[model samples]
Target: MKEMEQPVLSVRNLHKQYGSGCAACRDARRERLLKNYCPACGTVYACQDISFEVFGGEILGVVGESGSGKSTLMKCLYFDQEVSAGEAYLYAYQEGRQNIFAQSAQQKRYIQNHLMGKVYQNPLDGLRMNFSSLGNIGEKLIAAGHRHVGRMEARGRELLAHVNIPEYRVKEAPKSFSGGMQQRVQIAKALSNHPPLLLLDEVTTGLDLSVQASVLDLIKMIQRDFKISMVIVSHDFGVIRMLADRTMVMLDGRVIEHGLTDQVLEDPQHSYTQQLVQSLL
Candidate 1:
């Protein structure tokens, strides 16, 4: 909880447009709800004018209903999806001078391998189900250029244990593990390189309440142990309230309100945020 005067990542005026932009997109643009099909042109604006900053050792929560473009924004940041416009920079890379959006494929690959970790909503998206838990985490180390098999395997054991996954399961394929265990393996894989920034998208969405609690506890432990910055996307306020230091409320693909987690929860200014907080109450 030290003073975070510098941000680990900064995103400015980010946008993602799907389909041919036509006249209907104009209304979508005006309203900033460009994430859906345009009534006039049927263009899909998956994201528009998105901007945010994540500070070192801080968790920034992005909350919104499904299809609010929050997931699209995370995809853009992780380079899984392309952006139509705007810039994103990682402070840990090139001293925060390099724009991630403009990086060459090689440079981006290096960044992805060394400086970023992402846990997808689906374990299959983030992990190789057929690979053993150890192999899943080891792949990340290999990508980061760790060629020593012994060292990679050691790191894998360390990560799995750190995430509270039993060491006995290290050699088992994720396909054979339970849903929660698969998620733990995904988290361990994501953390293999000790990345400075971690992106989590709906990580607890489909889990049972007990499983969700355990996963959330594990994430909290990781955050404390690593002191890594995070951008967590979730529709559940309980998830945000439990983990985020700051929260951003997204509606119709736009951030309508954002501030300290306590402030946003206690004194929500946006109508949508107010409704969300009230629903919890």
Candidate 2:
């Protein structure tokens, strides 16, 4: 019998909340909060028992409106924010035996540099505005322990070119680039370490329509060429439709619907999901 392939990333029962929970919101069965907020204790539950898996060479799309916890989920996965409780396993790290959320801070930094990459909603979050485009990629390489300047520059140039950044602009700071170009540079930087998993948080949110299409196309190309698993968070169904093989819809910090992208779009089971799909039509 052929063995089932291990998932590249597995997240289970993940939870992140701002402020400690009180009796009013702590009990799962009895708690009734206002859209993931504990009115009584003033706690905001950012992610609630979130769970999902990403297999090799596939993109998993997380779609939700603002405050749905999708972005927060991404942050938790990338270790930008500490998870209140949960287990996340990555195949590339310790053969998926260790729960990443439980790892020490130093170990988490290793995972961030070598096992996974992230492109933030704001390029400023991912790239140093004052640094050149190549320097940004070099920074990730350096974090991954690369020291040879010649080799690092070669890699930086290769990734930048792969993302369609012109050779002439490699030395330019990201702040000098347009919104779309800055995102492209960020993508190049994220790919510099050749990580197995990538997390993208609304990578195309603020771009012009034409630029958004171009960035989306570039993302598709990257997934196809690199074969890296991706977890992309977006409020735009269009972006999700274009990139995701499977989709998870979040609402009030909970996953209300999950399925193949086509299936979820065609037969949405949750009321919020149905409304979201209807908005597209």
Candidate 3:
């Protein structure tokens, strides 16, 4: 059999816990910490033995209700939060290597600069409210050291245009735009560096159906146009069903079901996944 291509992102035996009491818990903290505790129950094990993989050119949808640790998992992947344990390997195309929990500041900076783009649920969180859309996009590009490649001002307007926002709005602050338009700006900012992996945390949340569809469509376009790997964390099954090639149903920070979108939607084996499917229907 032909060997499978290495995953763009590989997470193995991944575990994250909150409390300090349990024996297993102590061993599970990947980053050295003096203490731990179950943030919810005060018992321990906020995340337990979680594992998953994402390949290039794949849209991996992660679904679970609120507090099910959907965002936590994404946070870990994005390096927004440190993992308690397990391997989180990011294959850096620019560096030509697999980075399993990059330790050095330089490595982290390199990855942040050129290897990934992250989008969050809240536009305000990802975008700068004080700056114009052009400023927002240009600022990130400048920070990434892309100032020498092109005129930052021209590039910013081009990105705004690419996202279908009017050229006039490029000079307006994020607060001046409507929610959906603000989201478009966020998407543009995320794409500033053209990272191969895009991590989105409920990018369509709080939008109406029509708006949600449009945003999702934009994301699809980005994935296709850039051939980027995307991991979308959301509870909306309809969104996942429409946008994702494969899906992973997560509960309590563990993957309960994972397969091609059609198979999981049509023949869900896990009770949790079935419930989720039924709820969405």
lDDT per model vs. reference = 0.88, 0.93, 0.78
The residue-by-residue lDDT of candidate 1 on 144-214, one tens digit each, is 89999998988899889988888787899999988888889888998888899999999999899999999
Ranking by TM-score: 2, 1, 3
Q: Give the candidate order by descending lDDT.
A: 2, 1, 3
Query: After TM-score superposition, what is the CA distance of residue 65 in candidate 1 from its true location, in Å?
Result: 0.2
Error of 3 at 73 (Å): 0.9
Best by TM-score: 2
| Candidate 3 per-residue lDDT over residues 10-39, each given as its tens digit | 788776655554443345442332223443
Candidate 3: regions farther than 4 A off: 1-3, 23-44, 93-100
Q: Could you tally the backbone clashes for each prediction? A: 0, 0, 6
Displacement of residue 98 (Cα, Å) in model 2 is: 0.2
TM-scores for every predicted model: 0.95, 0.98, 0.88
Which of candidates 1 and 3 reaches a greater TM-score?
A: 1
Q: Candidate 1, 56: how far from true, in Å? A: 0.9
What is the overall TM-score of model 2 with all chains considered together? 0.98
Name the TM-score of candidate 1.
Answer: 0.95
Task: Give the clashing pairs for model 3.
Answer: 18-37, 19-36, 19-37, 19-38, 20-36, 30-84
- Which lDDT tens digits does candidate 2 get at residues 193-275? 88999999999998999999999999999999999999999999888988999999999999999999999999999999999
